[model samples]
Target: VRPGESTQDEPNQKWETEDWGIFSSKVRYAAEKQLDTAPLSQAITQLAISFVGTTYTPGTLEV
Candidate 1:
């Protein structure tokens, strides 16, 4: 959004909180949630399962 602002390749600069521009939050949120009363492994497993019905299109990432 400015002149001479080179499109530099860097980590967590432009999109520090986005995952594929969908849900946005830091990893600490998941870490803390997992570290709660539930075991981290279980939390991770359930979290992975939670996205079962979420929309996803093949080849989108291929571009």
Candidate 2:
């Protein structure tokens, strides 16, 4: 995973909340939503490509 830049030292420190419980819950919710949306996002991309159809014709490509 790409690491985000920190504006201060101890970058591992939670910036979300004073309570650990709240911070962890928010992280979990965000991660789950991203996971759920990933497949649909990929599907939409594939559908768009299918709609565009093949860009190359057979025998047109050569070594």
Candidate 3:
């Protein structure tokens, strides 16, 4: 949400659900491409979950 935007109007405001899904999908896709013979789907899913658990703040390091 943009500056001063209220969650009352945006159900997914504070959660950033779309970004999480997109990031998870991208990670899974990359893992699949890199480990084609032995698919890393489960691994990617776990890693994504772990990452989402971390407390995130603006300007923090990524990956």
RMSD of each: 6.9, 16.2, 8.7
Error of 2 at 59 (Å): 70
CA deviation > 4 Å runs, candidate 1: 1-13, 16-35, 58-63
Best by lDDT: 3
lDDT of 1 by residue, 1-63 (tens): 133233356322343223523443324556556645577788777667656787888854441
Number of colliding residue pairs in each model = 0, 0, 0
Question: What RMSD value applies to candidate 2?
Answer: 16.2
Q: What are the lDDT scores of the predictions, listed in order?
A: 0.52, 0.50, 0.58
Cα-lDDT of candidate 1: 0.52
Per-residue alpha-carbon lDDT of model 2 for 1-63, expressed as tens digits?
Answer: 123433355555433333455446555655655544568777556444543644656863342
How far residue 50's Cα lies from its native spot in candidate 3, in Å, is 24
Candidate that scores best on TM-score: 1
Model 2 ranges off by over 4 Å = 1-18, 35-63
Could you give me the TM-score of model 1 versus the true structure? Answer: 0.37
